[model samples]
Target: MSQPVMPAPIGKRGRAALGMDAQDLSTITERAGDGLRVLGLRFTNDRGCPAERFETLRARLGTSFEGIEIDSSPGNAAGIAPSAHAVLTVSLVDEPGHPTRVALDRVVAFLAEQLRH
Candidate 1:
């Protein structure tokens, strides 16, 4: 069997834009609350994966997935790293709708599949 692929590390700027500090990103693999489902991913700069990829992913995921980028702070002394990190928020249409654990799983699976190629 193939070993599971680990996500790349995201930079400081990317983390802030996702409205997450390193701790939040570390403890929670995924979060479903409010009207949003948060999915996190780390990518190296060499991958050439730009912010547009998130939009494309959202489109491919269909209406169930909505991408949101929020401004956040560093939250700690950890300086920004050179790598890139991001959180993809998939908000459901209904009230109190958030991405369920299953949905988060699917998103991660989809992202893993995409990254393999």
Candidate 2:
């Protein structure tokens, strides 16, 4: 069985964009109130995704997944995972034409719009 891996601890830029400070990310999550969560992702081959790709996704997500818990494992999926209120996945592998960029843009637009409400 593959052990679940925690995403990197939220960085300073992410926290700032999320309007959070030194407090624990989990604690921030607890106070978020029924926000969207990107949990239960299973990576491919039981191996972790590349750190650079993960960080890219994290940076792209910005405050979209802020205060929300995210979890991952080893599995597979298509290039994009779109949720009702957010973009759930990005192309972990680099592809021609840069579909990841488009996905990230959708994520930012969707969640930023949600935040306005």
Candidate 3:
């Protein structure tokens, strides 16, 4: 909805969900393709929990993200903490027969809810 800029650091609650402390985890909103918006959440310290944590996240996600693609991988970002980091990429595409942009806020909230446990 707005112009893309540098990734913004997520809040305390989100950081806690990601098993991060001190080191920054940030997110950026950008266009992926035609009418596809992507939210890139990047973090350095998963405390080695990416595998189990994200697997659980993926399972709990289920059909909540039916039309969206959420994935994580080892990567790095400029101006982000710790240099080497993991990226949680959420790609949202417009659905046929849908009348509005995908509810990205809901997707993020659902992730937080599923990850908290």
lDDT of 2 at 41: 28
Which regions of candidate 3 are displaced past 4 Å?
Answer: 1-45, 65-75, 83-117
Better of 1 and 3 by lDDT: 1
Candidate 1: TM-score?
0.24
Which residue runs does candidate 1 get wrong by more than 4 Å?
A: 1-40, 43-47, 66-78, 84-117
lDDT of 1 by residue, 4-117 (tens): 022332563342233445576434333322223334332223133445445443543344344433222243122222332332333221222332233345566766865775
Residues 1-117, candidate 2: write the lDDT tens digits.
011233432554332232234364455455443553332222322233223333433454444332222222222133333221122334333453333334444456765876886
Residue ranges of candidate 2 with Cα displaced over 4 Å: 1-23, 34-98
Per-candidate clashes come to: 5, 5, 0
Model 3 TM: 0.24
- Which of 1 and 2 is ahead in TM-score? 2
lDDT digits (tens) for residues 23-54 of candidate 3: 32222111122222322232324332223333
